[model samples]
Target: MKTYTCQCGTPLFFGNRQCVECGLDAGWCDVCSETAAVSPEGTCVSCGTSVVPCANRTTYDVCNCFVDASLAEPGTLCRSCGMTTMVPDTSLPANVRRWALLEAAKRRLLYDFRTVGYPDDQLTALPPLAFRFLSDTPDKHVVTGHANGVITINTSEADPVHRESTRQQFGEPHRTLIGHMRHETGHFFWMREIEGRRDAEATRLFGDADANPYAETMKQYYEQGPPEDWNEQFISTYAASHPWEDFAETYAFYLDMRAVLDTLRWNAPEQVQDLGDDLPSMLATYCSAGIVLNEINRTMGLTDLVPEVVPPAVVSKLQFVHDVFESLRTGVVSQS
Candidate 1:
């Protein structure tokens, strides 16, 4: 995660409503590529209204969610906030804190999405994206990942202990708010790329999405183990279940590299900074930087935090994903 400083030089929270040193208002706006200057009235392009100020502003630290409605016509709510199809049942006893944690983590996810050039309404001028946050039983509400242009987040994920336990059970090396964003956005991109564009063709290349995504296949896998040689190609054993899973994992891997490259470009000296903006150069930089990060983690008595290696087969898949985004960025691919 990148550190942000207020214009006044005081460090501010990622979702800060006001800067302490200069009294300037600020909120992260990914489209603008900087911390947006929040108008004193609390208006911002991201949220479209003045944030509700903390009642205990003097005593407690909190992120600002202000929006100023009076200054001008209200824009849609912030991209992440707007996607909330459901909030936790506030009426329930233990839900209030859970909801708060979910919202806070969500803001961090949105920050990553916007910063990494994924489309948010603020960046694309599209209709607001939507999301649902709900609770369910382990037997009843299986959270199958899918994106039909809208997102659904199981509210249980808000529990830190539950998330950490699942991370350990799954043997995942890294997991966090930003990691979820990278993973789910993979589903979102699949919806964008596969929708109405030769679905049959994709099925031939990828696989049949028509297969019951929620099926006994997963139950069988959990009881048994992933197929043999799963590690030879797939990032995780679960990814080998279906092609859609493959695409999502592959997309997440590409996002990991993309963000690493951006961090490199920001930190490198100007003399060596002009690496060509192509998949090969970016991939090379990602590998080089990844080695340094791995070594540093070991120095600190931690394991290689990102254990997955990018083999040749995975690199080919990543290049296809990168080329698709490059075409989108350059307008070489028409939206129609």
Candidate 2:
């Protein structure tokens, strides 16, 4: 999440469609992890060619990466982008707008995965990752749930009011579209992290993977309340419901730290001008940055953006997860 500057020197964001200062098209090149000047012939560094459309500018309704076009037929969709197991039916009058927003969010999520040096190719290869955006039916599909390997997002998420209501209903102070993306991607990563590695130690730390994740294990607990000591053992109350939820919450917590760290670097480039990949040092830098960030938020009379503090034990766990991600990139652990 390092900052990007347009050719005109204006800052750019990963999802920016245009450079406000220069009137030029802006796009994220997965290979370089930076916003690049995109022309018709522009290509992503990861893919080495323009295989997809500019993710930033999707008016043509195609991938921005341009990697798919080079790997497949002229009009072929990128294998990664084509991994949409399901999309909301745009023909439905009410869904047309929501579906577009979801697509934009999905592309951003995929881009983040790539920016962090994980391959979408490997993720797609696993049971062929797919997504479904559906209209919620009280007796039918749940608003948000993961089954098998597919992720189902509720179309209602597009409505700000509905999302806010759900946040209040759940007693969550911070919830947003991107937060939803981080949480759901955690589920996808759980499959990668736990598959075939379920030893006693791993099981003890995470849980017995054999348990049914969807069953009402926490039915009684919800009726009563989360364990009185939830903060001691669980990442969040939602995580206390199931082992699978715990993993997802932990994974999301890792993503949150990485994102916040990136934001810190972006806000104070001079401070981290020559940073390295050492996790502990980076975390220390973020610790300092967090203090300043929270103080600034307080000055504005805003609540802390990141309220949860990662305890020492959790910090160690997060470092391990980051190592796992690094290993995956180096072929030490094949994401496949």
Candidate 3:
């Protein structure tokens, strides 16, 4: 979430398609790993490199990311937009808006992935990561989940009223477009980084992902509901459904903590300046910041900004995630 310098020295943000101060076109440069002013003629103003604007930006006014022009082929998308193999039918105006929201959240997720030093395309063995947005029709209902690296999101989840209603229906403390993106992405990463390679350790922390059939576990979970002490052991009631969910939920929370800590680093440097000893430093910073954020939300009569409690067990699971990403970042573990 760190702001970048526009070509005109204005502050550039992730979603900027045009610099507000200078009126120059702006987009994220994949090579520079920053959002900056770029000409519509396919030139990065900041880096002096040729880059192609994402087609979605021009056609639908949805994207603000660019692809390196030298590497881009006909119809090539930017890093984030490229992963999307399907988008909801854009003929409907509502579907277009949903796609916009999903793309915005996705950019944040991809930014976090890059910030954590994940390799862009290193997992050759696993199915390629992709996103598919689908809208529910009369005969078919699209479920939001992940399989074989494909993350499907129901367009209805992007509607504010629908999302809030569903949140209350599920008894979730917090839910939103980014939350859904982060959560389903958790499933994809588990398949990519942990499935067979680190299952033993992951199981030790979050239980066995293969202990029971996922369908059966999910069916039983909705039928019986989470345990009374679910909050003590898991981040959310839904997380208590199964171990894969446990891992995905924990991973999603880990992403949330990292993203928040990044903002904290900018606003209150003293609070999250150093990620000393990794997870412990992060936890300490998060606990300190969450207390203030939660109180501020309470004062405003808003939902708690950081509602999920970081219990001892949850911290252990988060520690495993930190280690996994750290290993990726430092090349301490072989991705291949």
lDDT of 3: 0.85
**lDDT per residue, candidate 1, 278-327, as tens digits?**
77777776776778789989999986755678766666667667766666
TM-score of 3: 0.94
**Over the full model, what C-alpha lDDT does candidate 1 score relative to the true structure?**
0.61
User: Which stretches of candidate 3 lie above 4 Å from their native place?
Assistant: 39-42, 123-125, 333-336
Residue 211, model 1: lDDT of 81
Clashes of 1: 11
Lowest summed lDDT over 10 consecutive residues: which window, candidate 1?
53-62
Candidate 2 structure quality by residue, lDDT tens digits, 194-265: 556534434665567577445567675567767887777666778677767777777777676677766656
For residue 158, model 1's alpha carbon misses the true position, in angstroms, by: 2.3
Candidates 2 and 3: which is better by TM-score? Answer: 3
lDDT of 3 by residue, 22-139 (tens): 8888878887888888876768887888988887877887788787888877777777887888998899999999999999999998888876777776433458888999999999
Please report how far candidate 2 places residue 55 from its true position, in Å. Answer: 10
lDDT of model 2 at residue 258? 70
- lDDT of model 2, residue 110: 67
lDDT of 3 at 298: 99
